[model samples]
Target chain A: MLIRRPPDLLPSEITPEPLARGRRALLKGLGAGAALAGLGLPQISQAGSLGTLRPSPLSSDEKLTPLKSVTGYNNFYEFGTDKEDPARHAPGRLKTQPWTVTVEGEIKRPRTFSIDDLLKLAPLEERIYRMRCVEGWSMVIPWVGFPLAELIRQVEPNGQARFVEFVTLADPQQMPGVRSPLLDWPYVEGLRLDEAQHPLTLLAVGLYGEVLPAQNGAPIRLVVPWKYGFKSAKSIVRIRFVREQPRSTWMKAGPSEYGFYSNVNPAVDHPRWSQATERRIGEFIKRKTLPFNGYADQVAGLYSGMDLRRFF
Target chain B: MTFQPTPRQLTAIKAALFLLTLLPALHYAHGLWSDSLGANPIEALTRGMGIWTLNFLFLTLCVSPLRKLSGWHWLLRLRRMLGLTAFAYGCLHLLTYLWLDQFWDVDAIARDIWKRPFITVGATAFLLMLPLALTSSHAAIRSLGGKRWQSLHRAVYAVAILGVVHYLWLVKRVALLDPIIYALVLAILLGWRVVERIRLNGPWPTRSTPPAVQPVVFMKRDAAAALGVPKKR
Candidate 1:
């Protein structure tokens, strides 16, 4: 059963309460009863009505400092190279009003679903993951979304779905990066079938109990925390399952510099510099990089028999 | 027997100056190893060290031009120190590329330098800096003698051109702004030499003198306007 708040109270419930005693006791009593309605986690449920997935409990922050926050804001070079460019350029162009994703390719259910239908397909969950960038800085973001494999599974990929490729919206009017000849328009990223099924990969739609800001890849974006930031492409429009490796944008720019896998292995250095160390975001000094970006325990099994050096 | 220092106390003073000149270059290296570089440290370190290397190379080139045009013979004394400082920073730049970037893999480093156009230009600049650095000592000057030493050191001219080329090639597209500014500054420094050479060979032709003098006078007139003055005829 999902909990459904009364329409009037829903809007006010998300705010911090000043009238504590009366509202707190009443809200607590109502929350207990409301849990019977089968609604997702109430924290995000009260924030918006996007039919967000019911997220898992907030994860622990093992030994990291308290200074963790979004280390970087988006820098959309199409609008301009400035950090605030994406916020200004993204909102008006990527209107979610008529957003829909065509889930075709080799899937049992080949259907085009509206963005609303997609959100309702699964219970939203939140996961705090460390994001490392190829440029040698990192961030810890508590993102709200569910596993991407959950969505892929619902479509029921065919036996030949060895790879899953994500294609971002290509309208030059919307994504200004498409204007420049720097890359093939409509950025694409892919993961091997098993890699896509990894429990850690997230399909993020919101952060901080609010709808994801336009600059933050609103509606939907992939979050593969262990890899460098570029691997998680933004503003996705299509998903294609294929047999061969898809050409990645950064790798196309400089193959020697950016590899296909791009897993954060400190030992395999980039052509221009070593990946052995990275500056923790918001901190002054760079720390030694850990194997698989410190999530080796969880992801190490996936690469058990293969050589990271060759893949990297 | 050694060629003893001229009454200039050349040995002690030159050594002290050499060590002092190394401080700024050393400070950059310290920042690199300690990771004091801000966000995007790779770029910060790359650009920071790269710009300093070019500046030192430019400063080295300036010595001969300033000596010739300004008739400041004493400026010649600092040429070796300035050239060596350029070499030191060049070495640090390459070291960052080696240890930090290639993880000290000689084969991989060699391949990249050979294959990439920008890296090729940068590597040529470093290789050219090598002999210049080796020949910076008084012993090297004595062994080569004055004429040979001057000819070998003329390689600094080649180094300057290569440094600018490397910078231009690294950036995407032509990006004429930065390279153009550096080119203009270098051309002015080189132009001063050309002017000094023509002046020494013969007096400036009357025709060229009139046109050249007009721009200088016009610049002064513009300056005079700021000072609330109409120049007297």
Candidate 2:
């Protein structure tokens, strides 16, 4: 789909001729010290004293430890079986500074918005979310971003828009993980009409305070915290509002293991394991997966009256 | 290429080889209990155990080839145990995916096996390993008789190939090194068998050759139940 780029920003990060990508903009506007310091919180907690005596501030409600930290720190298994693979390998390759998301499919304005345009459209807010993976593990990330609905409204959805399909960048040349055959590259994810419209869903651009690390889907990505991590498709390149149910990458790969809803519920057990419990990242010693990833009040209503066992 | 292997030495070697196959799975379980499994430990554990199971399957397939080509008859005794151990690790690999990855989500798991090619192949390999494991016991072997038992265990060859295909396709990219090594090992094992088949001309002959009209030993359907493998497809 053709996309109308915002008044500012280039179409792609890479240019034949030498030109600055977001380095100057990010450093000058955001402040390198502030950005680095913001990213340092996790590292400090990860490296510093991790024992029963000293728990992470992130785990205000739960007993936290290093095993719990593991769930949060290293999660992208598609990149490598190692937990730290995504973080260690993702940063430089994912050029986020010059990123723009192409919004198309059943929209009043089939346009592309620059990172700056997104920030100007709506102010950023931090939501402490508990992210549960389909693999029975969980993590709480204090994500800073804007509501997904706000962006959807800006595009002006057409009447036919019944679902939102999110596509991740699939550049094996840039993303080493894409080079692996673990999954179909450029991981795809989607949400139903109502679910996409839900207030809890976020079109996250940053974490801590700075723009999201490239490893964390830099620039912008979907964040359905209460659902499995796969629901939060990283490095979003396309945002399509479709009439039919979009085929999700993981669901298509293994439909039995991944459902359309993918809500975080202990009742539904993946054939190989029980979803009844989850090891909360950072709260390794004291982590216990809660209903709706401990955000029951915010998201439990969405799945009301539905049988999780069947959907799961 | 043929050499002599005694029944007594074969029995002992088979028992030891079986124990060796359990090491990887036992290591994984120990890691899980010791909290040594890395973050997202299940993936590593699952992948490790799965690859090991496939490795053992290839190793088991090589026994006859090694015996014939290397002229080491002792290899034959290790075949059954090696095959059984492969099945054991295969079971653990499947369990890890079910309990750790899918969380007992039967519908999701079933859908994955049906929809995903890798999962389908993996689940099939595991299922194929089950009959091999069940029939590894001496009692089942005795009941099935030698010829029938050998024929039943031949499923290991298919299971090994399927296991490799499952691993190869699971990667988003080819993951060139690991899968290639596995393929190479499997190729060498199978290749040796091909050579042995050519050398022997056909199935190996025993000390006793039947007279002009020897009574053929056929496995009765009821008795076939005792063998490890399902009656030939």
Best by lDDT: 1
Candidate 2, B73: how far from true, in Å?
Answer: 4.7
Tens digit of lDDT per residue, candidate 2, span B100-138?
Answer: 766787886887787667788888767766777877888
Tell me the tens digit of each residue's lDDT in model 1 across A1-312. Answer: 222233555333332333234323533454443452235433322324323334443332432222113413454444444344576677767665566777778789878877667666677665667777775666666566778888888889988788888887777777765676766556778888787888888887765434555677767778887788888877677888877788886667767777778899888876555576776754555677878778898888888998989898
Relative to the true structure, how large is the alpha-carbon lDDT of every model? 0.66, 0.65
Best-fitting candidate, scored by TM-score:
2
Segments in model 1 whose C-alpha atoms lie over 4 Å from true places: A1-97, B1-153, B161-233
Stretches of candidate 2 off by over 4 Å are A1-32, A35-60, A63-84, A105-111, A158-160, A177-185, A208-211, A254-257, A266-296, A303-312, B1-36, B72-233
Residue B118: error of model 2 in Å? 12
User: Against the true structure, candidate 1 has what lDDT?
Assistant: 0.66
